[model samples]
Target: MKKIMVVLMVCLMVLNGCTKDNTQDYTKVSNQTYLLGTLVKVTVYGKDVSKEVFNGAFDIIKNIEATVSKNEDNSEVSQINKGQEISLSESTYKIIEKGLYYSQVSKGKFDITIAPLVNLWGIGTKNAKVPSHEEIQEAIKKINYKHITLDQKTNKIQIHQPIELDLGAIAKGYVADEVSAYLMEHNMGHAIINLGGNILTVGEKPDGSSWKIGIQNPFDARGTKLGVVTIGQKSVVTSGIYERYLEEGDKQYHHILDPFTGYPVENELASVSIISNLSIDGDGLSTVVFSMGLEEGFDFIEGLDEVDAIFVTKDKEVYLTSGADEIFMLTHEDFKKKQMKK
Candidate 1:
């Protein structure tokens, strides 16, 4: 899922840097928070056309939320949650189909069938609380991507076991891609789609320049800088433990849990960001890499030609694949020196 706190922090920083006289005409829309979460921002560069483009983009986002939201009473996902076979919109069905495929590709690391465990922990909900060992085991028993049955003929979905399907990890990127496609089809030349940190840059600025995207520092929430990446038309997605988390006594629990253990994966990684041509691919890959840890993720990225990854370990050590080094620009002198030494 998109980290709410980190995105808000980035927005606050961006807004503080901009003056009212120089603010761009950006239309922002946020879904119901603490539930099936999603936020979309569309900015178009044209006179009297900003509102029209924004409305068009907003419509697409709303349609996606309605189709995929688990909290929606009549949504296809909600029906799956209730263990009822239901027909879904072609778009929604395609997303679920892709999700299951990715789950297999990642060796069950990226799972949409994790809704039961997510709800049990209430990570992003008002009732956010931890669950007992027994409770988690029971939830895992019902959590299996193989249990989701799809009928290609009718586009119907059937849950072989009692489970809830949550696409929180992948839906935002898919929505962003959809909105970007809509804008391009409608003659939008230059735009930026910031779905609350799941950013996708389409075309370029009207002045013909690449969009500047800053990578958030995983350790210090407000202090330190990671680096910056320039993109003309690409997606940048970062998944970190510092995002949505809960503290209890002297320990802390993050929302990104492992389906195998029904607890957060214990690893040295602080965050992993992926850049790809498609936002949905980047979104799904980021989660998969995080769960796989540094070495395995590194090996996996090295095999892919079109994808690049940036990983920050718990020791504050940074690792970037060769593909990532092309777009990543180190702003900190010390970081630059460290890279040179390596």
Candidate 2:
């Protein structure tokens, strides 16, 4: 799972900083809770709003988590992982369907069937360790997205192999989008949905300006910002090696595992942030681009429409896609923004 620890706080600080003059009469309703194995903060700015709106939004998140989370023993995913061919909710079915699409898009680099490799290393859990080469190779053999069988008509799923499925990379984004839509349906025009590192803005800020989102400095403390992105009604999601890892002596292993090698992906990138109309796209693309490394990832993102990316190298340099230059601003002098080759 991509757990963004400090970026959420930085975004809250940015939103709170806007009301210094007290001239904004827009009502701000905010609440925080622990969900999806991370902190989820939802805030809406509108006139005559009540906190009760959050209850519906949070319920949507809870329902998705219950349906898709592999950690939940009774989740539909878990049941399917256990060799049971089962019916899925329309939402869960769509999430898995999209996960498979990303798997194909990244050429299996960003696979939901990577749970076997993830469990073997257990980077974020106490069981984390460097598995034997033979063990890793065995796990790799089971990490094929092609083994998944989905029936579109009945919303049923079956696994043809002994593979575990983990939707940690993309589930939260789906939840964020669902909540955003729910809030909008209730007539809230402006809001910030921060599901750990996945950020989706409902509209602009209450004052008719873009919502300023702090991009986490992968090498620094969590709340420390390397830059801020000004966006309206878009989602910002980042995947990085610094957040979750396992260390052995002088060697450190990050949570992002390469399915082919059954090891952490080695690259020039420390993190990749994607901005898009839907949080799920940002979520999946962030991981996909990170795995592609800097140059190829930059070119790939540049070729895509409605998607822009920020590639931060381990050396502390920043590279932005064509459209990113308009909204992303460097806030730290320590990080140098580089110009991408045309």
Candidate 3:
């Protein structure tokens, strides 16, 4: 399975400064709003567009976030976690269903019932601290997706045990997908959406060019670009350990917690970028592949269909899968390219 694909021995350099103030096109309309605990930006290309167009698209994101956000006390996910049997909206049910599907496909590598572990770690909050080994062991016991039960008829979600579900990995992807669907329905010629790094392009640019998404340099705190993934009308989502971390003393712990270990996934890869037609798939699989480590991560990607990954090891070596070469183009010469799978 280890075969060399298109290996381009090209010099990859970072862009000096963005020449375009917004997107490459001027007819495209864009709006930014706060949702899903992050900044959500949507751009659409066409004429005679009202503010409601963007507002309507953003409303879908807001409604879904309010439903599944684990932090909200009145959220449906929160209610379900509290042992109350409740019915979910179609949107809510579909995301949880997709979340469970990824969990099963990853064989527990990606789980929605890992909120207990998240709360225990509290990586992004002021409560972030290292918990006792016993506490981690206790949290691990509840990190099973099988503990959640969903009824298709009534659209109800029930937690069998004290399990909690966190849809952070998949929610933004789903939101992006929803926004894209809306854009397509409205016959938007070209658009780009950046929901705090989870990017989705609608159709192509007016000039019919692929969207150049910068893969963030994990080692740089200034959010520098290490490479660019050229894509057209696809979702490019990169998950990294650099985003949110807890610094206790001299050690650093990232937010991507392992479901089985109840700790940050310790691997040679610093970040993993997943590309697919659907942002949900890219979003969910990025974390799963990260948790699987470099060796097993490539194996997992090979078994999948229409999915590609870019692995940036802790040593700064960039690895691209077979199909990844179609979109991934390196921008940093300091990083060496590793041999990819067939």
Candidate 4:
């Protein structure tokens, strides 16, 4: 009887240990917060995931907004634009440096000083308007990225003119990258950071499979996606005129403005989505590629390393880079995929 009792107890303990291990191996926790005028969500999957982990990541994002956002009254960007030379925090300095780099590399195709044009059109604003020709020309004069000066020695930034700095084009992506790094540092190996439309992943999906991200249909309303990109640990950032626009009479005006024309960008490509290692790179290049149009955009992306793009044209034609075809799967049967040869 004693021998039988000992064997039964051992079996009970083994079953309990297995159950605990299974539960711990696949725990997932997530949280959503509103910041930077959009919904930001952090989903973490690991044995040690917690609400605290998500909160820590959210804090990093909010900190970025407090420093980089022009909307914030005392933000570093706002202070500099107000004609006051202000010293920057580490985060602010890095972002300013990157914005300038993008401006230089894209040859003014993407400019942070294009804020004046953004305000004039105000596509997503309550005061949205179709500005007069003269009004637009005046805004164009102030939309020069070269006017932004950064003194690396003192970490101070200066807007030489009346132009403002709007990092809306790239701030969310940088924040996502920062949060993702934090999660990985703490051993939260598998995580997802969704900042508005910008998404970044720290590792493969919980099932050890490739992660899947959806590309929104430009013609459809929000939540309507045309395709999915099956990727692993990458940032997916999409930019489109369809994101924010205003309709007046029979004409439609989008938020994406041309710094030179001070008007919405006119192009055959409806939207461009970039997938890259860094979210900031993906976000910054999305605007640059969108401004370049379809053909030139392909040439631009092909010159880069480890960056792929999905270009959706105005006529609903989906164009993919050679690398994009391997991961992108069109979920909506209505759209056709065209992968161009190198």
Candidate 5:
């Protein structure tokens, strides 16, 4: 199995605040488990919080994993990849639907059907390798989003081609969103759902303030912060070349592959962070924008509504969208914030 190392791009800072005596008795309950290829942690602070809440949240993740995980032998995606028609679960159907939307948004640059290329490289497994030019070309030919056939009425999916579907890019965020919804439904408002660094804040801090999130320093070790972003009830997700890669001799290949060339994307960006109301959007857009490089990605983000981005270049310069400055604060001297030229 290929496991994604904890890409701690956005780390949770000290979540402390002073609450007014009249409304400040919220208790904190948190638990961590290994699920969906990474460490999943769910923390909730609210009156009457219980272990059952965490259990239910994690259970939802497990259920979703079984339905959408491409690595699982009998998952819906796996079945579809094998060209076996199957009735999909609601979660699987919606994730595939949204994945197709992102595919279109990136003009097929961030394709979920790039599973053929993903397996060809195997960057995160013991079989990790650099495939031959011919192999890469073959894999690229199989990566087309149009092969996926989703029957909304029957909740079934069919793929006539030999393409495989990998949901790694967006599944984590969708799981986080579902968990967040579950928390809110159970009256747990203030919570932090971190699925291996895909951070989703449920509500304001117990003290009625925004949560402080540290943006990871791409060139530094895990937990190192280049800056901090303060927000309330939003999803913050980051994608970078440092997240996963395979090193061979003096050369290293990152996990973000380009469907066109069937190789790791070559760009000036070290990382891209997307902040949005939905974790699913953040998850997909981070990868989509990262592949677009700094300039194009910045322009794309500016055109989108209710979305903000933080782009950190390999040269240690940071660029932010218009709305980003309101929530983000640069704290590292090594990383200087630069204004994107209009």
Candidate 6:
């Protein structure tokens, strides 16, 4: 009787272990709080994974915030702002270099050096207020990416003007890419990293399904869905006038600003979302497309290959590039009609 009881106990323990393993096989959700302003949620899907993958991914994002955030006293961006030439990590240097290139490519439409203007407007902060014309002009004078110089020999960065560097636009996407890479390295079969609205998918769901992302409708405040895009192993980023804004006395001001004018960009579109292989590219393109009005934005999308875009105009018109039309599903009746007509 004792021998029989031992066998049964061993069998029960084995079955319990198998069940636990199966539960972990489908999805493992982990979240880390860092980045100074946002929460990073990482969902890994695989079997027999350790906590190390999550820790490593979280560390990458934390390191990025340490390196890039102007709010951090020890950050490289802070050093540059204080007129100190400081050496940067390779990842930090790459992101800034890409930011500078995009700033030039977009003709200053998307700029990291517009931090002064951002602070003056204070749309996303507690002190949100409208700045005077003179204040805006002074802010604009300090807002030029060209003044930021990079030393190739020492990999050091310097800012000629008294300007702050804000990576609010692209840092999340870059961190998403880094986290995705970390997951891939750890043989994480499938994963989704949603840094606020900046989403990156690696492989597919555990059941071999594509990742579905919902684009928020700019007109709706209660998270109404504008459309849905299904993608695998790609990054989806959206830049909108709705995400962060301030309203006062029948006037509304958004966070995205025109670097030259130091005011909110006056564009026909309410929001622009980009889907691309590289999360950083998607981040940069979303801002660029939003700054470009409808006509120029459509032209830019048509010129690109492998990059898809969806634009929601202020008039509630939805525009999809040839590539985007394949994966996006319209949820609203008006947009459904428009999609049928196309």
Q: Which candidate comes out best when scored by lDDT?
A: 5
Candidate 1 similarity to native, TM-score: 0.87
* C-alpha lDDT values of all predictions: 0.74, 0.83, 0.78, 0.78, 0.85, 0.74
CA RMSD of each candidate after superposition: 4.1, 2.3, 6.4, 12.6, 2.2, 11.6
RMSD of candidate 6 to the true fold?
Answer: 11.6
TM-score of candidate 4 on Cα atoms, chains taken together: 0.90
Residues 110-157 of candidate 1: C-alpha lDDT, one tens digit per residue = 788988888888765568777889999998887789888889999888
Off by over 4 Å in 1: 1-39, 222-224, 333-342
lDDT of 5 by residue, 172-212 (tens): 88999999999889988888999988999998897788888
Query: Which scores better on lDDT, 2 or 5?
Result: 5
Q: Tens-digit lDDT track for model 3 on 1-342?
A: 000011111111122222254344346566887777566778776666679889889888888888989988999989878878888988789889999998998799889988888888876666878999999999999889998888998998877777788888888889899888987787775777777778788887666666677787778743477888777778888877776777778888888888877778888988888888998888888888988888889888877898899999999999888888777778877788898555
Mark the regions of model 6 whose C-alpha exceeds 4 Å error after superposition: 1-25, 32-36, 158-160, 336-342
Q: Model 2 off-target regions past 4 Å? A: 4-24
Q: Where does candidate 3 clash, by residue pair?
A: 12-331
lDDT (tens digit, per residue) of candidate 2 on 8-46: 222212434236442467777788899987788888777
Model 6 whole-model lDDT (C-alpha atoms): 0.74
Error of 3 at 188 (Å): 2.0
lDDT of 6 by residue, 28-129 (tens): 655556443644567776776678888898888888888888778998878877877679888778888888888888888888887788778776557878
Structural similarity to truth (TM-score) of each candidate:
0.87, 0.94, 0.90, 0.90, 0.94, 0.88
Q: lDDT for model 1, please.
A: 0.74
Candidate 5 — worst ten consecutive residues by lDDT sum? Answer: 1-10
Rank list by lDDT: 5, 2, 4, 3, 6, 1
The candidate, 1 or 4, that scores higher on TM-score is 4
Q: What is the lDDT of residue 201 in candidate 2?
A: 90
